[model samples]
Target chain A: MNRDTLAAREPLLLGAPAPVLAGGGAALALVLAAAAALLGRRELAAPGLEIVALVVLAVAGVAAVLLASPFRAPFTAGAHAAVLGLVLLAVVLDAAAQDGRNAVVADDWGPMVLPVFLLVLATLRPPREVLLGGVLAAAASSAAVAALSPEPLRGVAAVLTGVLPPAIAATALGATTLRALRRGGARAVTRSDAASVQEEAVARLEAEAIPLLAAVEDAGTITAAQAERARAIAAGLRAALVADLARGWLADAGFRVDDPDGYAERMTAAQRTALRTTVASLPLADFERPGLASVRGQDRDAVLELALPVAARPRRTRVAPLVPLLRSAFARADVRIGDEQVSVRVELTVPR
Target chain B: MSDAVWTPRFALSDGLRAAGLWYGGTALALALASAALVVGDLRAVAVLAVPVAVIAAGGLLLVLPLPRPVAVAAATVVMTAGATAALVVLARSAAPPASTAAFPLPPLKIAMLAFGVNAGRRRAPLIAGVAITAVTETAAGLVGPALGVPWAFDLPATAGLALVALASSGFLVGGRRTAVARRASRTAAEQDVLARTRAIARSRAAAVVHDTVLGDLAALAAIGAGPLPPAAAARVRSTLDLLASPGWADPAAPPDAVGGPVLAAIARAEDPDFSVRLDGELAALRGLDGAVEGALAAAIEQCLTNARIHAGVEGADVTVLADRDGLTVMVADAGAGFDPDAVDPDRLGLSTAVVARVEAVGGSVRVFARPGVGTTVLLAVPKAAGP
Candidate 1:
């Protein structure tokens, strides 16, 4: 996609924010350092290595926080890996300080730190990044444990069995959270688009109608040209009324129509008159009269059909006074007539 | 969404919800403890009884109408009684006395009272349910010693305590239901008033449409007229258009939204000089409804118009504020404020339209001004009673 399309999509979701990721990364590092310090309080067998690890973690966390705004592109994916790599190095150093004793770093406290890396990385990055981060967590765990253990092969196997679940579970949770947020953002965008459309329509109506209403109220008299202008304005208002009705029906998505044709039959006598009156009140020439007419939309149906009858001649009734009103008021029309019938049946579908 | 011609759902009392959660959670905890206690005993014929009663308790809560759970209530009582009989036999068969009464409170009695009292619409069911629970707990305690199983409480004391506890819980629940029922009835009465007001408004709207729209059409169609003056003809057409369209066709009512009442009131209170500025968190206000809003809007429009014509301001400044409980709009203008007391008592505009309109819907309007200072009409309307 081009820059314009990218900009458009980013406005709603605004692709992986760096500050949040950075803050979350620093928080994880603090928690890990705190956990290590608490666990080591009993006895820091390798005091110099533990101090170096703790110092490195603080510097990296400070860098992550201070540089979050500038480090937007690829740095987001490596947040956890950076934090964990420092911890792993410290562990390796501590083990080395023990004269090749792996147990000093390979103990329960060190390996338990692997899951926190998984959680932080999974939560901060997108799905693909999370998947990659999980892979790195597992690999790092296996390598760290093996280097610190007497039996390297057994350490690799143990890390795979015990540490892998947290890595995978955290990754899945992060991916799901990312998916839900994206979906919600898309829904908001869709609603905003619809609202803007409605707003535009309302705006247009006011622009055209406001001046004309003001002119009528001001002049208190109509010239032939003004009458012609009023005729055009009246036509727009007529279309607006029908469109508003159709839009209302559309807004009610679960609306249903159990019996399509019977919908017209279901209208009360007064309702039927009101329906015709609503349409007939529009301004149009005599030639535009509909030959037949029927009432539409009353249930949950998306399509609001106002059936108008087309006549053989210019025979007019209360409903079929203007055929053009039905045409302008509806989105689509379905017409049917028998050979001997007085007028053809035209079912106009009002647009949502 | 609201119209006089349609019938909506009957109101659900909030007491029913609290009662359900309280009873359902209570029964579940009791059922689990009872099941764990008796699980290892091989002689438990009715080990399934306590668990089934828990399921029945959930079922009772699930029913929509609280009074209509008779079948579920009957099923529960039978299950509890059977469980009590089985537990008694097992306890009698056991060697230890303390083990026979180790359970905290009577599980069967608690389940029966909770579910049975839940289904009560009147006082009889409550009384009978409590009695059954007390009697059964007493029976279980009394029979324990005969079979060499010593119970925790003396039979009489156990029975008396059970009766007191069950009766208290039942009566308390019933009282909650009564209060909820009162609220529901009040809501219904308000709904009835709302429907009647809508009907009257609809008729008034139809009459206006008939008088102005059809009347203009007749004037246009008359053959006796030589020619319509431009002003006269223009008036007819514009008037007809407004009268016939959806905006005017709709009997205006309060919409749910913080600015909705003010905006709707603004829409109908159409004047060239009347302008509006709205503020506050609007998301929660959308559920507010009915003629009360329309009335408030119309009143605001009236205030703005009154300011323009009487107070000598170019246009009125309207500020809308919405908070948790209700909405308020302040229409202020730096114009010649008047001695409100000196105004003619017969002037019907403010008294009839602004004051009366808001009052009808249980709202208030305050007008403040001085000789040189501007006028500020503070129009405040509480949210209409609803969910």
Candidate 2:
């Protein structure tokens, strides 16, 4: 399945709470525990204190699962905090469970803790600092648990079994995820930079081309070879524009079009054909004829009356066949026909 | 790859020293921990100590800046040996039968595989180091339980995690290098384009200043000194007026509009210096673009100006060549010559302006001057190739 579809399905399957909620619960629990210890007497019921801790831990676990859900924002400070809280709650419960205390342990903590850390490390945006801090905290906490337990040797063994591997794994995963992100970012920046340089080069070439063409035309003796060179320069400009258009089209399709040269030849041919067909249809008979006429005849013999349909309206049906012939003639000779003149002239056509 | 290089030797010495110190410390720690456990008869603690000693040693090896390939090989051997010894001892332990299960297959194999794979990578140091750590941890975790040893089984997961960390670090380093290279290349390209553009601009400016001002002044000076004729003074003044007016000087002015005045000025500049002749119809050339005409006229004037100033001897020749390709104005002096290279066009008053105007129309200037042989300045300009 595609990432978006998979992401959509994530929360439904997991029924996870949002990371922010879990983080809030954990923070509240910590504050309450500290307040209870300091404000209330030591004789206060241990069961009551344990019950509160369990509720807070459960809330934090739920928050962690929600934050880890595929639909959650990949990189956020709140998500990291929530994941960290989940791990801490797991550690506390694991310690409690080992002591045969039924009041606070959760069945899912063993399965959830490592995975939550992994999810946080993987999805967290800019995971470097937070991941490092989390790993360090976990390692230190494990060491503390080993050192402070009543059965020091067994406690150290428990810490090693429960804490070291998971923390190290989380650290490794976090570092890898951060590297992948950094590499991907670097690749994107490089590509954009290359594209910009190419664009600038094309712009410079275009700016130079216009003045150069003008100067060549002004010289009044442009060779066929020089004209071809000018056309090549124009082709380069057309290719650049086509590439830009294709990029926009591809971006809309959710893909980036990277290779301009790959599609250039086809685009150029299509554009050239379109331009040729458009130019071929334009009438040019008026330009062929001069504004003034000069005729030399010896004494106008017999006063010949020639009624050459000067104002006859051309048949529109003749336009299609006549256009090609007219284009050919105009190509060889300078044609300056106006629209009004074409309308009033004799119609010319050829069979299809 | 070259044996002659200084870098390779330096890297080798540094790596060897670091590896020796790390390994020695690890061996000493292991010896001390073993002695403590044996004396106290703490079998459980002894099992833990062995793995801990091995791990500490491995970590120390990685922390040092040893060559990656060498480190990977060393780590693989050390981990394999440590695992074997822990397995043998754990099998004979007093733990229950279930606790003494055989080591899992894949995880142990993967650890060994990682060692070889990591050592083969291009960035060997980072890849191998992480791989060794990962494999060793995995092997320890799986093998420890089977032998009834207390070795930690978290290493495989830890190694996998380390792989991720190392990969990210590599990316950051590679990204920085790529950015630096890209910037350097861009800077070089920009500098090249700028240099070419500046050279073109400087040449054009020199030509324009010479044609309009210095040429007129020199002709007037000649006529005032009375070399030959009285009619020359009138011609000089008319030429001066055309030069002073905006009509001829401004690029936007019409060619035919300034034609009459320019032709009069040219006549004045030419008549007093030599017996002059004008060929080619001025009216026929009038239909051309104004900028083209102006460039052509200015180039011609500069050539004449050069002939008068530097020719030094009598009867210098002035030729105006024009075609569809553009115009060429040649001024040849039958006078004592000077080196063209040695003569700074700016100081000579004619060379700089003549070269600039000709090149402004995508043309060139050739100065052939030698002592006792006289000089020839040929300026060829194309009409369509403009500034």
Candidate 3:
């Protein structure tokens, strides 16, 4: 699994469908507008045309609400397109009702409503998909106007110039920004060394083990005390070996924890790395309380807490960039900037 | 191991903010330019400038770290009111029909798109879009006749800009999703590496103990407390040498470079009545990491002991299998079996001796048995630590 998959899964699996937000808003607006037209507050050339337009707008509002509902499977691109199509059809009907009242175009509502709907719909898709949808919508609307207007070319020009720029520009701008960020993030990823981790693990144990063993070899024979010492060393070695087997990057990086059950070991690689980097970024002198990092496991959930120094407490700007990675790695993360210290608490759920 | 975690380079929300600013600013500029050309009177331009300035202030809010829905709503309302007021001023100034036809509608549509795209949550963008669209359309319909502009609203322009906003928002969401997936996969791969590296470390540590501490203790036990014998001294010196060697810690060094702990355990576990019929991929055991070897050896011995002491059987079967991932050992005994779960929690036989040992090397233990059925213990160990 990837970071995107993990993060996306939370929202995609649990959150309301993407289109629902736009659909609700659209329904409210359409309903109000339909009510106004029915109340004779707005003028339509024909009474029948006015009713038909209102009915179409009401249908569009209902369609938007239906689109917002959860599907058994993924809500596909076709579904989004269909909903957008219905809204556009409402726009066409509304415009047609106002056709005779205007000199050149039907009314401003047709021009304004479609783009707003498209803008909301675009949020549900990718840049490319949005581009295709935008282009298609613009082209279809232009064609419809051109077919109806005496000045067909002028009508098409109007649509292409006035309707299309905002969506296209948004796609271009967003895509550019994302690419730049990805490029920078790639460099950060490249800096981690895997082999050094092994070296670090080996070094941690070698310090205590080598001196004791060498003294035994040099003594040549075991005295009552030496034999006793050897037995003690053996026991220590066994305990250390078992403990070391369960050790993770947290202990390796010098974070203190009362983790007798080795709950720290259950942390995913991303969590370890992110915590390591974030801790490294904080100046040691700024630490509010030394060795304040800990992981407490309750059932399958592990809650990790770290205390940032008093000096770092006010520097939220510096910590902001690091927060996203931490949040992404853990199931839930809260960073509280307090007067005494900056406290970061993260919770993650491990598999049984 | 490749990297601790994969992180998105940039935030999608920030990108949307930038886009909002760009689109909003662009629309404002266009509106200002159109008002300048249409209303030649400097006084009319100055009058239009008041609302334009307010719209600019509203656009600034989009980039601020304020609540997104609130910011977008505030900005959209400001733009709508400002644009409407400016159009009204143009109408009073008697701006030409063609100049009045387009004046603020297209630019306002773009500005509205900007607000909607930056709204940050569901329905807000649509609501912002619809609200702005309604105001602009209403303003245009009322102001168009006053100015005698043939077409007050640009329908195609509105539709086009709406599609653009939709596409942009979609792009942002897609980027965010991609970043999340990348981070998750990296996390998974890193976990795999962590486990393998742990197993490898466990193996190395076991080797160190097997050769140094275990050997020294055994020798001391056998010789008693005394001055060293020449042979014993040499053995002690050799153990010291082994501990001091940097190669012992090097992952590339074969774990069996010193001694095969798994073989030793097998030899120690065996007796005449409780023979182990060792079979299948025996050669693969030679390549086992020291941790895996030590754990497997101890666990196997414990299983055999359990079989001999408990099972009313003559012999047991031991099968070792190797695959791309690692090794799997099946120790089966046709004897008196008991429910694994019902086994005393304090009994070190299965939990500590077998389960703990196997798990230490990033391996798993599965004990399958029933009252009348045979017991089978399956131990699986990975070859290396990571993805």
Candidate 4:
């Protein structure tokens, strides 16, 4: 899988996990900031709380923009609290500067930062986080205003104006976004599965049926040998595709396969897929023979043992290419062959 | 890294890329700004000229039309070191001419800091450069206050701000390259796997044609010459049955092996007087790869062919021994046995088909026999299940 595919696994935040949306949201905020800066071009009469407030807002804005990137380290739980801390500090500074003329919460531009802080977090966090986080943030903002402002009533009302819009936006939009993400992931999986099914069907056609079809197309006459060849190819195709017998090993394992005793979890998804493919390819059942080959091993150990009965020759040529793949995946591979009175024994052990 | 050095298209491209210019340029600009920020120290500012020029020249080389690897490295090293040394002299030697100092860093100190932004280096190297600058500037902080050095300086703020710029720029350059390198390696490994798969498929087709088509054609020739004999007919039927199996081309293990398991294959193929023996858990063979299993079966088939044609005996012994590492098969016949080494090298029966096939699957083979004694052929393979 590529980086894009790995990123696709993440849940969409507020319906904007894609690059265009992620970039657009931050760009929209930046453009708005620029517009606000242009509209209210007030000269700084003095630099005290105003400078501190600007600096805090700038830092918060940069953080917001960086957080908006689709590819990012996962945001932590305390991250929202950190944003709240910045707001707390900014609100305290703004309030201290007002000196009782009016609540700092009621200051012309002081309280505007609350919503921006919330939006930054809402767009980055999961839906449940947005829900719980929005409440905590609103309460904290109100508390900051209440504790710091001399006019508690006016302060609460002003803080509410700052917090409510973004809080609602984060909750409703966040839920919808998560739902869409879930739907997208499921749809992608379904499409991929369908494609594989079609591919397998096409491969079967090419491998078994096509040879006979090509022969018939090329030669009008069908000889007995050719007819026999077609029938054999058909049977071979069936044998390759379907195994009717139950494996003796599966019965021995005591049906403790669902959890796999930590073995399944320990392996990477790719390794697990490879294991399944290898096992499925092995000829576990033969109509003419009762027991030919089998695999038996525990997950704790790296080596997986394969016991194959030999007659005239061992099945080494067919098994050789997989050796490099196995060695790359596992720790070691060893093959041993022995002879008995009527049959031969071929054994292979691969450890990881 | 070696590819960047060797390939003409990639050579020095990372260092010379248009994106790399900003790093060196920013460092040089910061150095110049530091020199400009001095309050009333013309002497200190004058002293900044030499190191500032060096930093500018180095930064220019970094951003030039095509930056060379050797030149870029030399520039970064010389400029950073030279600027730090110049700042140290300004800090320790200058006298405090005024009581009030508005700027945090003197011109020389600022230049040292500007040079500290080694963006080509990652976090560790960038931080080290900044640390060295901070240490060098501490001479001013320690001596200026104690001995009334002429110029005023604020080491803490200057150090902190310089660290941030240097660190951030360094991280940006290093992190991006690291990500690109990781992606490149993954793609190369995947491509190798794809190529190997294609090769295996081709070789498997060849094996299939050799085993089935050629055999059938030769049988057909017999039928064309005269009526097909019973044995010939049986042979044709057997060939057809093999062709009808899935993974017929080169199956390590046949998905639909006729008659279930190894026991059945042996029972059907063995002569009346032949015997069988099994050792170890049969379950161990459960998940063997089809190709590996197919090789084992084919080798066994070859051994039986050799025995029937050359052994001149009705009875043979087959014994299977499974171990922790793998399993082994031994085919022994008590008949007119010949020296193994005496077999014609041109005859590709036991040597090429059986031995080579078994060995290919990471298995081993041993043949032991003497005149008037029994012959024993052993084959073994090892494998692991990959998810």
Q: What is the i-RMS of every prediction?
A: 22.3, 23.3, 9.6, 18.1
- Top-down DockQ ranking: 3, 2, 4, 1
In model 3, the runs with Cα more than 4 Å from the true position are A1-75, A96-108, A148-158, A187-219, A223-352, B1-10, B17-95, B98-105, B108-387
Superior candidate under TM-score, 2 versus 4: 4
Q: Which parts of model 2 are misplaced by more than 4 Å?
A: A1-65, A68-71, A100-112, A115-153, A160-352, B1-78, B88-387
Segments of candidate 4 deviating more than 4 angstroms: A1-47, A67-72, A75-84, A103-111, A188-352, B1-387
DockQ of predictions, in order shown? 0.01, 0.02, 0.11, 0.01
TM-score of chain B of 4: 0.33
Task: Tell me the TM-score of each prediction against the true structure.
Answer: 0.29, 0.30, 0.45, 0.32
Error of 4 at A283 (Å): 43
**Candidate 3 docking quality: incorrect, acceptable, medium or high:** incorrect
Candidate achieving the largest DockQ:
3
lDDT string, candidate 2, B55-75, tens digits: 345545543457865666676
Interface RMSD of 3: 9.6
Question: What does candidate 3's lDDT look like per residue over B1-387, in tens digits?
Answer: 136433332344455566666566655665565556544667877887887777677666665678877886777777767766766666677454363345444565566666566665544665667766776667667766766655443543454344544444444443443344344445544544554444444455466556665776667656667777787777767866655455454323322211256645654566756666654444456556767787788998888888877887887887777665678889899898888778855446888899888888888989899877889999888764222
Instruction: State the RMSD for candidate 4.
Output: 24.4
Error of 1 at B259 (Å): 30
- What's the DockQ of model 1? 0.01
Name model 1 segments beyond 4 Å from true: A1-46, A67-75, A78-88, A104-109, A181-352, B1-243, B247-387
